[model samples]
Target: MSRTKLHLLVPLAALGALVFASLSYAQATVGTFYQQETFTGIESEFVCQPSPIGVVTNTVTESGHFVITDQGVHIRGTAIQDYRIDFADGTYLLSVSPSHFERTATSSVEVFTEAQQDRGTLYSADGQVIGIVSVFTLTHITWRDSNGNGVPDPGEFTSEVSQFRVTCP
Candidate 1:
């Protein structure tokens, strides 16, 4: 090979290796995932009374189709709330809100790794806090089976946390 051609080939080979290495090491988690909140008990001033049984609980469910990018994990999705309200009267309301929330994913740490942990804030369609107030940790990349139970539970995945609320209810 000519000297000039050899020099050019060497540089090209090095550049190719660099590109391949970077791509191989890139941390990219792009897929659809759900985020949810389980019935973590209720907080209200007015004690509800039911003739049969009084129950207070809330479930906040949200999901995202996220792409891990250099900027951040960009996600666009919605949240729907299914709740039951027990009135001070014997009347009980089993309601799925007429409204669902749409939100853009916000970030504290955009980078993703296996078992990466993060605590970040989320905003609803109307700019209300919908995620956990204290902290929301992705304990693992996805679902984790704890308590040695083969069946997956509600709080077993990244979707559900303890303190999540759709609004102050």
Candidate 2:
């Protein structure tokens, strides 16, 4: 090859490599590590109580499995939670219950924000979307006193707020 042609080819090859590297960095995969979070919320019969007696505190602390493919990111797992009054009346209300959840989205940041964008959305350091986040309603809830008792009855309240999040480390 001629000297001028050789120089031009070398520059072109280097430019192509740089562009390829940038694109590769921008893309995501299933990931080597799992993104995890702990979900907790309060359920009560009374409107809002600073003290506890009839109020139930629920928590779900479990790791979820996630996969990011060409189509989108998908997450699936069973979250188990325990409830308790932790107050005078709720000592016996703590027990583990499981809820199965799974979601598929175009990006890691889109899953949690799709239905409740105002509540949960994750952003990158440079303002790019990096993950999904926030507290949300996991299921329909009922909180009526079945026996017509003024105080909250056992198992009388079971409404939960859950949060699912994912961010690349």
Candidate 3:
């Protein structure tokens, strides 16, 4: 090859290597969002009985969607809801407010490996336990030997799981 061509190829090769390195680094550091909360339409309005002449509170429920995204993990479609409670009484009780909520949802994802027996739990941004994703239907398994030594490196193994679906109750 000509010197001019060699010089040009060197820079191009370096650029390609740089790009690949950046992409790999980004993928490695990319973390998953355990829980996503989206607001849906309005919910039904309710009236409180006994009008808590001293302290009255009302509870309301609304529905929304929660999406979980992770690099190698598979998650299914799931929905969540936001609940609010208003107190009509003069007393301002923090406990009366609807600050805590819980829901159980089922999600199915194809496990990439039979070795992986358990599905990890998903957490909300606020560190709340949201749902559990199970790999009941394994579709494929991929193995990578990063060192090119024909042997799997410790902590260097990864797999891809797909066909994830979710159910919320």
Candidate 4:
């Protein structure tokens, strides 16, 4: 090839490599609390994760009082859960539950990745859309309720999960 062409290609190749490396480095695994709720003096735990692979166990606990009224009951119980966050890539994983509960509860997994462009969309293995996670930005994580309990519907549980922000490590 001509020297001019070779020179042009050299920079382009380097740029491509840098872009790929950045994308890989930007990949992160983190956890966040989406919602939380309590009923009859019992409180539920909130958990989140960017991926399910190789996640460390974590737990959180909170103790508070609850009030019951004729119209509705107000419960203030403690929340405890475990979580791990990947600050280098903006990924997280978390396992949350109530410290008072004797039985173990099931948890869900969710991930959000940066979009290639503004019009980009994210899809799961089953072709269902989760959400769009971008670089340097917080993406909404989600979990599915394995149980068929009508109280905690499938897809996303907001009552027991509290929202959290992903910070850099």
Better of 2 and 4 by lDDT: 2
Model 4: residues >4 Å from true position, as ranges?
A: 1-52, 82-164
Off by over 4 Å in 3: 1-115, 138-169
Tens digits of per-residue lDDT for model 2 on 85-111?
333432223334444445443411223
Displacement of the residue 112 alpha carbon in candidate 4, Å = 24
How far in Å is the alpha carbon of 98 misplaced in model 4? 12
Where is model 1 more than 4 Å wrong at Cα? 1-28, 35-37, 43-55, 98-169
Over 19-126, each residue of candidate 3 has an lDDT whose tens digit, in order, gives: 445455554322112232332232222212123222213232322222222222222221222222222432121111111111111122222221112233433435
For this target, which candidate reaches the highest lDDT against the unseen true structure?
2
Which residue pairs clash within candidate 1? Answer: 35-159, 36-159
Give lDDT per model, in order.
0.36, 0.37, 0.28, 0.29
Return model 2's CA RMSD, one decimal. Answer: 24.2
Model 2 stretches with alpha carbons more than 4 Å out: 1-28, 31-42, 45-53, 86-91, 107-169
lDDT (10s digit) by residue, model 4, range 1-169 = 0001221233333333344444454542221212332222111221222442332333333333322222221222333433332222234322232322111122232222111111122344454544543222212333445564423455454333323333211
What local lDDT does model 1 show for residue 166? 27
Model 3 error, position 69 (Å): 45
| lDDT agreement of model 1 with the native | 0.36
